[model samples]
Target chain A: MHELSLMEAVRDQALAAAHADGAIRITVISLRVGELAGVELEALRFAFPVAMAGTIAAGAELRIESEAAECHCTACDAPFPAPDGCCDCPRCGAISRQLLRGRDLRLLSLEVV
Target chain B: MCRDCACGEPAPDPAAVPASAPRELTLHTALLQRNDAGAAALRQRFAAAGVRAVNLLSSPGSGKTALLEALAQRLDPTRLAVIVGDLATDNDARRLQAAGVPAVQITTGQACHLEASMVAEGVHRLNHQGISLEQLELLVIENVGNLVCPGAYDLGESLRLVLLSTTEGEDKPLKYAPIFHGADLVLISKIDLAEAVGFDRAAAHAAIARVAPHAQVLEVSARSGAGLDALIEALGLALPAVR
Candidate 1:
């Protein structure tokens, strides 16, 4: 799964940052995974420990903040949270909804010591 | 004397060992921040050089290679160089080169899609070969032929071209709408065979429009060179220097 690859990158970056800060261990790694990012949280969690083996981030708890899928309705000119499996404009019932964020995968914070 | 011997045998202190070090360290960093940072840098580089990068995505046998070969032959070599990605072989790269343009082949091993890091590496290799980004007008990265996986990764491209060959049914966009939603331009390839295969071009365009309301669709046949000039002109307009 791509989650494994993503986890490998995450672990590498976390360890690098911890090492740079002269930290002996990492306790928590915080991340924001957007609802539309198409990443499965359980799969990511399952892959993290395996990817973290031998790294400073090993055994560190992963904190994920999932953002809801959102879109801007071109027809209604309104911003609303997009419903699951549908991009239709909620207010106007038009199918001209443009995505407005909520598809992002960002690492916002890391707790290291 | 027995009491004195018992008192002389002192019990060991249980708190002698220092407490174990803290088991947690607070790290607040986006896991993809590093890749995003790299991609941003690459975007700035492309902008500085006035190069427009287009990342192309489609399933296998979707005519991406054929489209590239045709584009390479049509565009002036003084301006265009293509970087192609595939799971194996440099066959596409070879074809592009034969069409009289410089081409670099990126073999992703077992990876399903091309990440920004891989594109960064490919750009660096191209630079090492004396092909300056400033000299090139367009950098087309034909992504590994998988619509689903490639939709998740951003390759720092200015435009995202999603190809849907007529051979593949008209409902592909509806089934894999994420790729269509991400596309800036949709190329309907293999239009020459549409009549023979009973492919409906209008229905295909309608499906794409439903998913990507604003994406511009261009129908072309790489084998017959029909509609190739218009595609080239569109590319020229998209990347002004290519004209």
Candidate 2:
């Protein structure tokens, strides 16, 4: 799946950053995954060890934090969470045309020795 | 009961601290930073070359190649070029070439989507074939046949075209919201078979409106020569004088 490739990107950046900071070994890799980022967390977990093998983060623990999807209603000018995958405004029942957040897949922090 | 403070219960030895203790490093970075940077560079290049590029994405058998083939006949062959990507084989490229268009194929061994680097390589190959980006009015990149992965990649295209055939069902847009939401133009392909296949036009249009409120939807049939002119006008490729 594409999660493997995405994890490879994570591994590359983690190794690069760990080395740049004069760290010996990585202990934890922290990530911020959004609900609407088009990635499956289960698939990402499955790809983590495969992508991190033979690197400083070989045995590192993967910590993922999820961000909920949010949408902005153009007609009602309201911001609401899209937990049910519906893009309609809760305030006025108008359709939300703008997506404000919850599409991020970021490496937030890392712990290295 | 602190260990190293003046009001602590016990004093700590300075030598007891581990020298190689772990450190927390804040490196808030996007996972696709590298790909996004490549896309930004390519976008600058396209803008400098005055070329309009469109990235097409769809599921397998969604008529992406067919739409391009139809476009080849309508657009100027000398000014238009295409770069196609697939898991294997250059058959799509050959098909477009046979339809009288300059086409380059990038056969990604295992990748489900075309990254910016692959597009750059494809452009290089097209240039090697004497089709420079500067001379082209429109450059179409037919991404790998996928609905999920391609939605996350930006290949420096001015427009993002997504296709959904009549046979794919009406709820596809909502099911694959990420891809459809990112589309600048949504083409409902194989409209000629809509009536025969019982494709609910109203439901499909409603689904598209729900997911992609800002996208312009066009119903097209590559075989029946329906909506091709509108597709060309929507792309705003080039005029005869410019050619």
Candidate 3:
């Protein structure tokens, strides 16, 4: 998957943040990945070590929080739990809806020391 | 919690992590923020130059090239150019070039989709080929043909056009809702094959309405040239023939 490139970027950000915080190294990098973010968690776990090699994030623990997909129907503004490609509104049966979450891929924090 | 040694210890649980519990720095930064930054820069570049850069997204065999070719024959030759992205060959770019449009190919190799950085490089490569981005009125980016992967990556276009051919089926918008959700325009291509394929136009429109209520739907056929003029008009392109 494209997790390697994304992890490489996470490593870079971790290093910069650690440097700015005056830490000798990064201990952990926490990330929030949504279900609809198109990232494979297993691939991201496999890519972490290689992506962080030779950097401040070398061997740094990667914590990934998987968020569930949720959406709201565009027609009647009905909220619904959208997972596994289920996007229709239960209330209005309207297909079009504004996606409220489940597309996130964020680095929540960096444990540095 | 060491930076180097892995001494038979289990990785910490990702779910039980508290916002400010164990981490030293509460960064709260989006992991793909760099991609967002890149996209923002590209958007600014296009805006500054007043370029109408459209990112065309579709599944393979959705007639993106055919539509672009139709546009090539219709739009101003001097002002229109293309940047084609594909996983392997530059066949689409070659086809566009053959249609008399300045086309640059960005072969993504193993990548599934084209990123903003790749678009930047494509523009640079086009500049090297004496096809300046500034001179062109339209810069069409033919994204690697996949509805799923390209949905997340923004190539920073003025418009995002998602194409669904009639043969593909009516459930496409429902199945790949995210792609349709982000599209500025939803083009129903290959409408000429509707009769042969039993393509239900009403159902397709209904599906699109469910997923992308804001997207303007246009039915076009590159083969019979039906709705090609309307397609050009949708892009707000002042065709040479009309001029």
Candidate 4:
């Protein structure tokens, strides 16, 4: 639902990166999306072109890499997959101590010029 | 190719790009970085002023306004101020203002969530309206009446409060586990109507524990002035001195 603003940030970051490198055209924007990042990839894809239109990133290919949410259980010293940041370990049923992954909405790389 | 040429020259095809030769720059940046920075700045300001900023989250009609009003009457109005966010109207702010406290309304035109930047603006407006940050002991921000978008935003609050009305259902915590889990305090509002609505107290408490075991749960009725004292004490607001 709020992916439009997030895509705008991506567009701005991609443009800044391209401008810093003296690249006039951005060929591709690669993003790392997590399952628990509260971002919908399809919605982001839909908003990308609209946000990047008329900019240096116009017509750029948006490549997305999806990552699953993972959690760490400090109780039993185990790493496991969990849905959200707060999750009980499947192995021990103890509350996870740390969220290992799946909350990242990283603009990983940009292909430009 | 002519730069800025109005001629109808087709742009290069993005699909047929040779990936082997493309120059890739590694730019690992999080999308929420900007918002995070803003939140950090707000937190710094709150720390400097020695003020506790509380972010209140709940669904619509959860009596967030009523609770704030009750607190306003209990505490020193000069020490407490509120920032209310709504989609269309400033009625919540008006209600809080009627309680004789400084209240600012942030009407999110299209945005579903209130971000750190909005809090900054709201505080600025409140200050402009004669509520200085240095004098305020507490600043309460009542977020928009939604559980989803506000969960993702960090408004640089000293504490995060999530409210659940009994009429909403006992399984609300289970339904919205992420938001519930993120809360520092989970308040059950409108307990006065619990018996009339057949609100299952045990089930709700169990659900809240299952989802947010770390959060302190308090049952309150804003209308009856029930449990507000316990809340004030939990917040360490020093009611007797302030009142």
Show model 1 residue runs off by greater than 4 Å. A16-30, A40-42, A60-65, A81-86, A108-113, B1-29, B127-130, B198-203, B237-243
> Ranking under TM-score, best-scoring first?
2, 4, 3, 1
The C-alpha stretches of model 4 lying farther than 4 A from their native spots are: A84-86, B1-21, B241-243
DockQ of 2: 0.58
Best by lDDT: 2
lDDT for B118 in candidate 4 is: 98
Predicted structure 2, TM vs. truth: 0.92
- For model 4, give the RMSD to the true fold: 5.0
Per-residue lDDT for B70-91 in model 2, tens only?
A: 8777788888899999999989
Q: Give the higher-DockQ candidate: 2 or 3.
A: 2
- Report the TM-score of chain B alone for all candidates: 0.84, 0.90, 0.88, 0.90
Tens digits of per-residue lDDT for model 1 on A48-91?
Answer: 88988887678888888988867787767788776442466767
Per-residue lDDT of model 3, residues B5-51, tens digit only: 77666666655653333448988888767778888999999888878
Question: Could you give candidate 1's per-residue lDDT for residues B1-243 as a string of tens digits?
Answer: 235457666664547632334444445555566667777888898999999888899999989989878776667675777888999999998888888777889999998888888888888888887888999988888899986778878778889899999899888887776667778889889999999888988889778876666678899999998788877666654423544
In the order shown, what is each candidate's alpha-carbon RMSD? 5.3, 4.4, 6.7, 5.0
True contacts kept of 1: 0.35
Between candidates 3 and 4, name the one with more favorable DockQ: 4
Chain A TM-score, structure 3: 0.88
Give each model a TM-score.
0.80, 0.92, 0.84, 0.87
Rank order (by lDDT, best first): 2, 4, 3, 1
Query: Residue B229 lDDT in model 3?
Result: 82
> Per-residue alpha-carbon lDDT of model 2 for A26-112, expressed as tens digits?
999999988777788999999999999998799899999998878998777779887534576778877787888778999999999
